[model samples]
Every structure is written in C-alpha cells, then in structure tokens.
Target: MTSDAPHSLPDTLFDTAVVAGVGLIGGSLALGLRQRGLVRRLIGYDASYDVLREAEALGVVDEIKTKPGEWLREAELVVLAAPVRVLPALARELAPFLNPAALVTDVGSVKSGIAAELEALGVRNFVPGHPMAGSERGGVTHARAALLENAVWVLTPTDHTPLTALSRVRTLVEELGAAPVVMPPDAHDSLVATVSHLPYLASLALTHLVARDERLSLLAAGGFRDLTRVASGDPRMSRDMVVANRAALREALLRFRRQLERLEADLEDPEELLAAAQEGKRTRDSLPVVKRSLLPQKHDLVVAMPDRPNQIGRVTQALGAAGVNIKDIEVLAIREEGGALRLGLESVEAVARAAELLTQEGFEVRSRR
Candidate 1:
C-alpha cells in the first residue's frame, strides 16, 4: 500500500486518511474531513476496541482497526491524535510502516519533543500540528464534525521538512475549515504553555481551592463552574501537558503567582482593593469590541505590516475612510521590523480594497485568509 514515488500524494486527498487514537480529536477530524469531502475513506485505530467499534458505528471512520500500524501502509496521511505523552512511541511504531512519502502529522499540544523524536526516526515529512480547539468533554462519543471549524491549527515544521508535505497537511487542515498557522517548535511549545497548559493548571488549582469547601460546592453557581470547567478535562491529558511543557509552564506559574500576590496586597486595604477592581473593569471594558463585519463578509483577512509607530492607526484610517469598516483588528505578531495583523471583516472585497489602499500608501500588505 506504500506510494511508489517519494514526492507524490494520492490524487484525491480525502480518498484515504488513517487516524491513530480514535478519540475526540481523531474522531472529530475524521468526521470533519469526511463531511468536507477531503477524503473518501477514513480509517481509524484506537487502543480501545469498543471505542473503535463505536467510531465505526457512528461513521466517524470508514473502517476501524485494532492495529494502527496495519493501516499506515495504505494511508496517504497519518494523524497521531493521541496524548502528548504517547506521541513519541506512536511515532516510533508508525515510522517503520509508513509510506515513504506519506505526510505524517499529529494533534499534540506540545511540539518540540515529538518533532525532535520523529526527526530522529528519519520521518522527514513530519509536520507537528496543534489545533487550538477543544472542549472539557472527552472521548469519541462526543466527537463533532464542526469541532475544528474556525479554529487555529498551528504547524511546527523543521528545516528538513518537505514543503510539499507541509502544503498537503495544510490543505487537509484547511479542508476541515481550520486555519493553518506555521511556527517554530520551541515557539509553539512556549505559546501553548502560556495559553493552554498554564490555564489548565490554574483551573485545576482553582477547582481544588473551591472543592475543599463543602459550603461552596453546595452553593456553586455559573461563574465558579465556568472558571473551573477545564478541570473536568481528562486528568491524564492535563498531567502530560504540564510535564511536557514544564519549563514554560513554570515561568507562567511564577508570573501568575506574582499577579495573585499583587491582588492579595491590594485586598489588605479597602480603598486599594476597590481601586484595583475598578482598574480591572476599566481595562476589560477598553478591549476592542468584536463586531460582525459588514464589509469583508468572511472569516478574517490577515495581513503582514511593518512594525512602525502609527502603522495600525494608519491602516485602520485608510479602511475607515474608504467606508470599509473593520469588524476587529488583532496584532498577531510583532517582530523586530514587522508585525502580522489579522483583520476581521465582513467581505473579501473589502480586504482586497484595503490591501490596495495600504499598498498605495507605501505599505506592504498580503492576504492571509
């Protein structure tokens, strides 16, 4: 079932895709890929035979196999949608059986470790991806086709990675209605440690703090439930994330502690506490309103811009003057010389017009939608 050439992919990408670990992420990916006609046959493998059978029954996978390695022979793309801790071993097992040119990827939360391990295994086509999408709910039974829609899918590709392979994986991700963001392995880990892993840890701690009070549990309402919701996620997955990104997580934890200490210090004085609370509300209220765009009628138009003073204001002014109102503007990155800006608009035409106007103003702009 191996592909003959080392550079070619199957004609129809959705014709066959093999997913290891038919749990929530894997099952959802399979279903989404199928619904979008990205693949015709979706084969799945999981440690739990019962879950595998259920995936098959629910049409999450066209076929379910007990041995994941067996399916790799025929799969054009192999997605390792397992826990962070199990990624290394899974890569090892799949490395020996994978089609030489098959684009291999994963949905692991952390990337550096797995990327290094797979690179060492001679898997040059490996693309370590992490979809910044998930719910507190766990297991294959909760899988939904729309889980990845409008979500961010980050790809960490090494220098040795083939461009074609990366593009293939990007297409697959996009077909499932997810955006593919490329970043360095270390950057991916560091970013997720702050945004995902650290938050999960904080949620766990918050839950523990409240769980100790019997009265609090009895009177628990929406705010407490909302804050501690992530604590209900799979304990094993949460533990693995903390361990995998320990260094970054430690830094995040320290910063969090410092913030907490500042809050505690303020609480010692009534006026100080009230002022601090007011400041929090003021800052929160000042956040840009995320309105639905009337012009760019689409997801978002991402553009790269020079990191100069007044660059953002200039771009907004240009669009605003042209009657192309921006729904939301986000600065995704700020490098030494340039930055990436993501503009949420209601129409693609508005984005094109904005790009033209920015270009005319002697600024570089590129569509990143």
Candidate 2:
C-alpha cells in the first residue's frame, strides 16, 4: 500500500454507487470512493435521517436517501455497511430496487449467517466481506478515508458466486488501497472469532474485572490502557458482533480457558512458567512484520519526548520539512510528564533520516526493525 492514499484507481469505475448505513465504515468507504473518483455518483442510505443529512453535508456522498427507491436502479455497485445482524434484512429490503447489473457487498463482521441469508433471499450477486480495520470510536463523525488503507479486506465468495462478480469486488478492494484475501464464509467467521471477536470480549472482561476495585482502577497505567483499549468501543456494536458469532466465540473462550488452566496447573513450576512466558514472547516477536500484507515492510522508529504541548506536532513538522512521511503512528506510552511515540516510516532511509532529525532536536529516538 502507498504511504498516503491509493496508488491508482481501478481501470473500470462504477457509474453510480450506493452505501447503506453511512456509519463509520460506510461513510469512510463513501468518502474514499468519491475522493478517488472511483464512482461517478455516490448515494448514501441510512435508517436515521439525521445521519444521511450529515453525510450529505460533509460531502461523503453526492446525495442521501432514507429508503430504497428508483435511485438504487442506477447504482452499479451497492455496499451494505450495516451491523452484522441486520445486514440480511437490509439487503432484502433493498433487493427489489437493485438493478440486475448491480453487485452487492457488505462490511459486516459476521459472514456465514448473512451470506446464507442473502443467498436464501435470492441476492445472487452478493459477496460477503469484512475489512480487518476499525476504531473504537463510532459514527460518521469519526470516519476517515484512510481507515482502510493497508487493511486486509477479506472477501468470502461461495461456490455459487459468479467469477465476474468476485473479480470486480477484488478489484474494488485493491483500488481502495487494501489487500484482498479470499476465503470461505465459515472459515472467515471462525478465524475472526479468535483474532477479532475474542479480543474484544477479553478487553471487556478485563476492564470489568479491574473496575471492581476503585484503587486498582486508579492505579492502572499504560499497559492496562493498551490491553483494554477495545473495551471503550461502542457497546451496542460490540454486543451485536459477539452475539452474531456466539457459537465460534464460545468455542474460542473454551480454548482460552483450557490454556489458562494449563498455566495454572504449572504455577508451582517456575521453569515451566518461564518457558511459557518466553514462548509467548518469541511467538509475538516472530509474527510477520507488515501492515497485513507480506510485502512492503515498514520501518518503525520510537521517539521519547517530554509531555509538553506541541511535542508531537514539532516532531511531525520536522519530518515533514525533511520530506519523510509517516505512514502510521501510535502513542506507545503515556505519562503525566512524558510519553513515547512509535512512528511507521516507509523505508529504512526514511527511518534513519527521521532518527537523525529527531535526535538533533533533542528527542530520544530508537529504530525498531
């Protein structure tokens, strides 16, 4: 993926595109399509009138509609970006309005259920998809066109899915600056249950457990915040996601409990505990380094700065002045007086330049991989 935006637009473009829901994912996709000139016209549909109006006002879409109508007939592409549980119902309602040439795709987290429902409802061109990218923050207000950049956009096409339809959706995802990974609907659901759904539930449980005592809650530090960050996500959305994939999530939880039991059984054996900890460290460290994709490895640089105003701004400005663009950034640690920022640079040269520039500015900078 490019550092800033899409490297190139798709050769074939949609004449008219409709995005349903117009929430965080929908609005971001709408903005990206419009900004990249991938669609000639874009329309947004949401259950809430205010959301549609806001999306229109923000130019996220060319127009807004409350329900399916003749406008949908003009859409060559329709994106269903609603919650996991309601995707089938939404698609069913909009099915009649969709033209025969239109290809429909959804950004729902769950796949098997919605894929079956859409198929049962006679939506033949449906491609079940889920982008492995999002924020704890919800709504169109938090939407960003770059949200999907470098993200792994999974497309689960069934055997009955037309080859032409799958190709078009894959092209669309690539043009949107994301990697397209094709798998079965059930495989996608099962895999995400462990990596995505389980993590959210774990975050929620940890936060809840710690909240039981005011003293522990107050004493919580950067590590606690890092581990439980997903707990701050929209509860309604989280609930819908986990509940929709409940069976897989339950199995994942059971596996996790078994692992925990194994660890508990070895607590008296210090060497075994050390071995487990070392194994976890090695496994985590050995994880393939990249933004989901195997190619285009990123060079990371960590900078420590005083907790003064404009510290981040100053470093970024210095890098900008040097033509060193930052692909991604994270606040690795935070404190009352200082913090550390991890910056993802595009190349080794960029990281070296950034380190030199920041060091000259009196910041403690270190390169990581």
Candidate 3:
C-alpha cells in the first residue's frame, strides 16, 4: 500500500475474491484486500459455520458460502488460506470449481509437500505461497488488517507453476503491503523448518516441561515466559505443522540439539561457556534484524566489556568521539572483570563506525545486522 514497496500494484482489480478459511491469515488478508479496494467483492468459506458467520459480521467477506463449490467457481482470485495438511486436499477439492484463469495461492508455512500434492493434482493455476507473518494467537478475532504489512510473503513456485499465477499472487501480496519473496518449494520448506518450526517445537517442549514443575511454574518470570510464548499458539495447528514437515524439522532439531549439548557440556567450565556465549553473540549478530516497525529505526550493537567501572562511559564516549549518534546503551552479561554492552545506534553507517571505534579502543564489539 506504501509508495516504497519493491513491487508496484496493478491498476486492474479482482472481480470476485474467495478466501477458503476465515482464520487469522484469511481474515487479515480479506481485511487487507477490502482496505486496498483491490477486490469488487469478497467471499469466504470455512469448515466452522460459527467462524464463517463471525467473519461475515466483521465485514471480512461480502458473502459466506456453506459449500466450496458455491463460491469458488466465481472467484477470479482464490486464496487457500488453510493449514498445510489441509491445503493439498483443498486444492484437490478446488480443482473442478476453479475458473480456468483463476489464480490460487496459500498462506501455508511449509511448501514442498503441498507443492507436490498440487502438482500431482495438475493444478498449474495455483501458486504455493507462505507469508512469514503471524503471532502466537490464532483465529480471526485476533486478526488485524495491518498484520502482513512489511512482512515477507514467500512464493514457492515449482517448475509446473505458471508465470501468470506467480505474478498475480505477488501483486496481491504487494497490495496487502507485504514483500513477496520467490524461491523453490523444497528450499522454502527446509529454511522455514529451522527458523519457524524448530522454534515452535522448542517452545512447546520448554513450556510443557516447566508446567510440570510446580516451583518452576510459580517462579517463571519474563525470560522464561518470553522464550516459550509461541507454545501458547493453537496446539492443533502447531502439531499439524511439525507432523507435516517431519523430515526437515527432524534435521533442524538434530542440529539445534547438538549446539545445546555443547552448551551443556561447557556449563561446568565458565571460560568455555563464556566463549560459546560470545560465539553465539557473533552468529546471532550476523542474522538479519527482524523488522518491528515501519518507522523509528535503531541498529543494535553488542559489545564485550571487561568488568570495570566506567565501561559504559568508555563505549559511549568512543562512539561520540567518532561522531556517531547512539540512541541508547545498556549493560548485559556481567562477568568478573567486564560484561557485554548493548548499544543502539541511529543508522547503519553509525553502526559500522561505532564498531570500528569500539574495537580500536580494545573492546570486542558485535553488530546485529
């Protein structure tokens, strides 16, 4: 919706848009299309009559269909906004109902399995898409029209996928204020399995384990709660996700387990533990920063400090001397001699200069990209 998006919107609008599920993603997308004036009419279909009714009452759809065939037949743009396990089956069901030229896309997280299923169904009009946007909460009641803004909507187009289908989906994603990323189906599945699936499973494991310990439950604070927040997501959907992407998720789990094992092994050795923590800081620093807001930019710099008075002053002073503007600074990971200092800089160039200055002052600094 903004002028700064990488993709430009098509002046041509959809005549009839059909959303297959009235959950968080489906509802949010419907709201987005309505707000953008990209669709003349919106129709929704859901397994739950109550949810469908609610979606209609919320103005998410102009029409609600009791059966898939009733509405999907008229759609110029069909969004299969359902679970990954259900998408393949839904695609099969949607086959006879699809308009010869209708563009079908999905919000399912994993893609390879669904892509294969759709490929076998001979659905060339469908483009497999995974929008990297969500919260722990589920359902349309918690959905917001702005949910997809600035989020990455990955389109996994197999060799069978038609170029027109992919283009239509990308335009829709842009109209909804999301960045559309293109990749192969298998690559999308493997990458998301680690970043998305693994985190949810880890949250599930931690929360369930802690809930069993009465004392731990009573004492669990911000850190524990924050780390396991995704466990509060819809359990049925979470279970479906892990089960659907078993092989990729399994590999990711193994890799994460190995790292945790190493961390556990060094718990007794403070020096090794600190070294591992520093290495983690560096690795995590190199990762792309998660976009939080469209405005108020801030770059985070993690600096290793020796335990001594005026360490914070030293770091900030160095940046100030280098003509770098730092927004804020905090102390973290206090050790015997020094600890880590987290600095917030105004811009990307400022971040580089601050890192250079701090390193010259004999401080180990890491920049979170």
Candidate 4:
C-alpha cells in the first residue's frame, strides 16, 4: 500500500473542507472534523436542499452549497460521502471545480471500481476510503460524531496517489478517532464482501424467509431481531451497495452455500453437529471485543434489571459516571417485567468495578471473563 513517490507538501491545517452528500456518513464526518477543530471552514453539497439545510442547522457544516462551483477552489480537502452507485458520477461532476492541490476521498463501500474510475478521470489526489461504521438508521438526523469513534477506516490509494495526500488523509482520520488501515482497492472490496455485504444479504434472506409466516411474530425474540437487524437499514442504500459489488458478493455467496451444505450433511451425526457448533462458538468468542485491539480479551457481565422506566439508563449512567468504558452491550432474555443486559468491558478490573457499581445500585449482576 506504500507509494515510493515523494510527498513535498508540508503538514498544515485545512482552511476549507468540502463534503458532498451530507447524509449519515457525510454528516458524521463533518461533525467529527468540525468538533475537533481540524478544519477552519466546512462546506457541504447535496442533491437535496432539505438535507443540506438540516445539516447546517445541526451545526454539521459551516456553509451549504446546493451545487458545485467556485467555492470548491478554496477547499484543501474534499470528502465524497454519496452512495456507492453515484460516487463515480459525483466525482466526475465535481472534478473540474476542485483545485489541483485539493485531496479527495470517499466513504463509498465499494472502492475498486471507483478508485480506477477516479484515477482515469485524472483525480490525482483521490484516495478511496470506506469507514467500517454506521447504523441501521439513515439520514443526517441520525448523524453523530461518536459514531466513528475507534472505528476502522480503510484507505485504498491508487498507484498515481502521492504519499503527501495519503499522509494528510490518514492524519485526518486519526484526529477523528478512527483507526486507519491501508490496502489495495480490490483487496478491500473482496474482504468486505464476505464480512459486510454477505451478512447484509443473509439478514435480508432470513427476514424474507419469515416475513409471510403469521405465527412467527409472537415466536420471534431477541435472537431473531438481532439476526435480521441489518435488513431494516435503508433499502435503497443496501441495494446500491450490494449491486455495486455483485462480483465479489456472488463469490461470497457461493462460499457460504458450501458451508451450509456441509452443515446439512453433518446434521445426522450428533458428534459432527456438536463439533461444528463448538467451532462456531469458539470462533465467535475469539473475535476482538475492542475494534482497536488486535488481540483483545473481553470481560463480560450480565446485569438483570426489573422492568421499570429508566432502569437501563440508570445502569449505563452509573457506569459512565464512574468512567467505566463499555466496549460493547446487548440486551438478552427480555421479559415482560424484566430483562438482562450483557455488557462487555475492556479489562477484568473494569468488569469487577462495573459489577460492584451495578450491585450497589441494587441490580443483580453476573461476571464472565
């Protein structure tokens, strides 16, 4: 991923930065940059005037431009946050207005095609990027600076990319509290296909499989809800993402099919089925708890709270007040009058501290490491 080209530009603050398509990702990036004082002035452009206005009203940007023009000339950094399908056209449209020294990047999930296209279009400073963070919720209204905290941000620079441009982008990403990773565009797309794209498709398929079953609603519980949560994301956005990376996604689907076939064949053998289940459990448990930690050993606690208003809020607030940073959280075994909340903490000491705090608040807690 390293380029041999020399980077002559001195490190400096960006006086003017531009963000196109200020939706969730764009709005979040704008908020993160502005909150950190990384840019002197932030300008936003979007196809929807309503979005742009809302973004400005929310203090996500300093100015909102409905279309590209001379204002782009002042921008030292430009982030393209549009959907996967429209990124190429958006880059092409904004190319002429951009100054020669400006650095360009994007939040588009599919990068291989866009990277090649931007390079061919003579966008020399373009460094293709995709942030591994977001929610099922969409739109600028859902945008928050904390959404990107500790997230993995992948940067795929073309052969023509200058080392200076990559360094500047990487610095900005770090300032925004995200971990920056460099890789080839094709490799990035291929890796995300199995982990990101394939999971969304699986969620969609599972939801569709049970959509028409009238009896499933009452039977559906936390597990079902968790498994299909991605299906509830913006449909048009999901469609664009999957379609844009169809080739890699197709290969991922084939690999997944083979796994399912093997699982089916092992169903008749109890030992084989148990072994498969154990392997899955081990693998899932071994995944790093903290996104920034390569080899994390997470400590978990299950807190049971009575069904009451503000119970969940109280628990989290108590931990937050104590500076107990929770690595992850999930609701489990929800009942009509009560429920269990599983919290993942970074260290055993933190887990002990959290458990003690919650217990002092009269909540039942169990710790597992």
lDDT of each: 0.79, 0.84, 0.81, 0.85
Give TM-scores for every candidate, taking all chains together and pairing residue i with residue i.
Answer: 0.73, 0.75, 0.74, 0.76
lDDT per residue as tens, model 4, 278-336: 99999999876546666344588888878788888998999999999988875543343
- How many residue pairs collide in each prediction? 9, 0, 4, 0
**Over the stretch 1-369, how does candidate 1's per-residue lDDT look in tens digits?**
122221244545655788898888988998888887778788888778999899988989988787646557787788999888998988887788888877799999999899999989998789989987887787889999888876778998887776556666776776677767778889988888877888888888778777768898866768888877778888888899889999988888898889889889988788988988999899878643322232124546656677678888888888889898788776544343566677877677877888788788877666654
- Candidate 3: misplaced stretches above 4 Å? 1-12, 268-272, 285-369
Which model, 2 or 3, shows the larger TM-score?
A: 2
Candidate 3 lDDT over residue span 257-320, tens digit each: 9999989999999999999999989998876544545434559788987767888888777777
- List where candidate 1 sits over 4 angstroms from the true fold: 1-11, 68-71, 268-369
Candidates ranked by lDDT, best first? Answer: 4, 2, 3, 1
Q: What is the TM-score (0 to 1) of candidate 2?
A: 0.75
Worst 10 residues of 3 by lDDT: 1-10
